[model samples]
Target: MSALPWMQHLIVVPVLLPLLVGALLIPVAQNRHGFKFAASAVSGVLLWLLSLALLGMADGGHWPDGIGVYLASNWAAPFGIALMVDRLSALMLVLTSTIALAALVFGARRWDRVGVHFHSLFQFLLMGLNGAFLTNDLFNLFVFFEVMLAASYGLVLHGYNLRRIQAGMQYVAVNLVASLLFLIGVSLIYGATGTLNIADLTLRVAALGPQDTYLLRIGASVLALAFLTKGAMWPLGFWLPTTYAAASPPVAAMLVLMTKVGVYALLRVWLAVFGDAAGELEGFGLAALSVGGMATLLFGAVGMLASQDGGRMAGYGAIISSGTLLAVLGHSGSAVLASGLYYLIGSTLAMAAFMLLIELTERIRPPGAALLAITMEAFAIEDKPEDPVGVGIPGTLAFLGLSFVACALVISGMPPLSGFVAKFSLFHALLAMPGRVPPATWLLIALMLLAGLAAIIALMRLGVRTFWASGAVTPPRLQISEVLPVGGLVALCVALTLQAGAVFDYLSRTVDGLARSGSYTERVLGEPPVMRPAGGEVAR
Candidate 1:
């Protein structure tokens, strides 16, 4: 394998593999379920393995500054499409592939059969996600963003019920507007800097005059709005809960990482292009980001309390996680950012597992029971029914119940879990800051505590209603395929908890390396540009 020709092209494989597989699967007949599942599963496993290898290479410093730059068609950076794999991007790729594999396995049981070309769409989505993470330029980022959004539109409506269609419509509308803003912002930035490559932009931004700097700031603000919308920031995020809730469980679980894409863009752009080197623009939007992040946290907390549906609750949990990360990034400290990265990974895993668990647990209730409860509450009616007491609960039920509790603890940032470790690290980072803590930082701390409290209350209520209330319990027929994914994610969270020191060390180094924009620029654009005649085409 090491001697293989394609092994040298590892960076592009993450995107190319999925794109080819998905495109090929489009022509396969739907009746070939065996072929579809086998193809998709094998692709998923290979993707996961590839991401692991990339992660190891990046973390082990096999590449210079833990950065691997791949030029398409042998064209130099800032001229042709380039893919960059660093510790941060590699980590994201690993997470994306891990979740993709789990979601595919879980959906293979039945959800994949509900729609034509499900596997194809899923693979395309993976391609888009991986490309978005790896692309070195904002233009390609927008392209990959649209690809991901398009695949998500299909997946969101995959199980095509009326409710899903309605939710998908809203989702589509919001993202379309976001995509437009993303394009406009990119155009503005390119106009200002004469380049779309992030590394080049970082160098160009430092040399801009006051007028161009103002324009660049405006462009960055517009881009930030686009990203904030996708990140589920308040006022722009009203569609998220309904959209996420409407999607099938496996799809919803996969969708958990989508918001992080926005967060990743923010971190990359902020640290690379707008860091301390951009004299006038240094920390230009941090204030707004912090304020918006706090608002998002507040919104998520209120929404969590108001939510009666498990899916909606999980969606709010995602919002909370996004908000926390946004606020921490605004702090502009490497330690805090490292802790935020840890929190980001832990929260995403816990939320994905919880989203998967919601569908399984909800199946245990009698049909229409939730609707009946709502109707009863609205009509001010109370009904208590006698229940048989001596029978023991099923093993599946107990497993799900315990899983739910673990998820709850993780989401709420309780003790003895990765979530708690992440929050604790954040707290320590905040306290360890060199200067006196600002009022805004204090407010962020307060909100973080409150958000956890809200999660605890909401999840406790949900647990009581679902697992403790008196009712006829209908045990859900659990499949090993479904159960394994949920368990695997939870186990990963536990692993993260146990390996916190090592993980934090890696993340800290990643953050430190990100602060050195010159190294990145040198590594990406140091090679000579490829010159071609006007009539000839270059192959990528």
Candidate 2:
């Protein structure tokens, strides 16, 4: 092969660029706020653009099977650390950059001013997120996971309030346990298979003898427990609402992406090692995944209805989003997977926007109002107007009200939005299967509809109380930085709705690529060593 162009190395840029910039920003003084913002903002823009290029490459089919693999230090795979990106990993990279940019802009408006090292922590988090998406080795993934978690620990406690600290402690404790589980699982797998590279594991698992198959299954189950805990499935996800509610809105918005990381890992690893290719291990744990997802969906919907606080409600909304993705992945159909990816993107954007919107909405509702309103409703009292004339809401109130409605519509999977389109596509695919729909699938369909209804009811109650029940509120002053990010996110969801056909086609292609895991294994394992500029000397 001819010498590779520098642009071919773009796969590493997403991970290395942020790591360099993050380290550079560490020594800069906090007083130099303008400098910090400029550096971080530039980094954010580059990461976004780089991700788009990578996404285009993955989708553009320039590489064989739309897969790109980078072997670090010019070493061969299954022996050296490797980085790989396909359609799914590239999609996640784009999502992370989008969310991180919005969070940076939102936080810089005020949250960064209150806290030290905010910019550095934010960039480090991005580095970890991108690294996690790219690494092909299991132990390398653990390294990136720690990098992500450590940055989040600081980011979660960014403002340093009592509530944040309390939530942060619990968050830390739970993740530590998860990390331990992750290690134990990795150890067992390594001991049994003699390799920690994910692609290599596929080869090992397929060739496993009867004795080793049992150990492989046990290790896989233990590993899944760790991912499920982070994925926020049912009983394992109790920490999400509290931590989300307590963190600053910008941080909370980023946390939404963190939760998806677990889902992404599960989807990637389970499909690679336990799908149809893995002989004895084929279809392992899928039933459990589906059941856990259903339970989580029901739990989150109920929690949304039960909670009065806006932040907590948004938190539960995140849980519902995760549940939907988990359930879909467990079902294992191409059409459903396509639609599920669509829903994942749309819901993530809407949920992040809602988390940011909560801070602004809370300003309009005075303390004790929620309690007093509940009491009045119970006692059959009314705050009736004597004249009974129409009242025009102020401009600020109008913006907040409309944004809240858009968010509610998207979250509840109502019509004329990406949320509805995604749900419609998913259900249509579910029933459109060739054979008769399973009884369990029917139950899943029913639960999904009820969950949407539950979200609608809960959000309607929130809207009534915040926008209507609490008399006229002075419109809070808004900042361009803050308002634009939220609007941008909502607008993206609207765009998703408008471009549903094209996006769905893209995702369908992605799902097709994912289903053929053979392509992934061949691309990563068969990739050649990097060529040197010198005469016929490759960096073996």
lDDT of 1 by residue, 203-287 (tens): 8887998888888988998999899999998888889999889999889988899989999998898888878787777777887
Model 2 alpha-carbon miss at residue 166, Å? 1.0
The TM-score, computed over Cα atoms with residue i paired to residue i, of candidate 1 is: 0.94
How well does candidate 1 score on lDDT at residue 512? Answer: 83
Can you give the TM-score per candidate against the true fold?
A: 0.94, 0.97
Tell me how candidate 1 scores on lDDT.
Answer: 0.88
- lDDT of residue 70 for candidate 1: 82
Clash counts per candidate, in order, are 0, 0
- C-alpha lDDT values of all predictions: 0.88, 0.88
Best by TM-score: 2
What does candidate 2 score on TM? 0.97
| Per-residue accuracy of model 2 over 413-439 as CA lDDT, tens digit each | 999898899888889988988898898
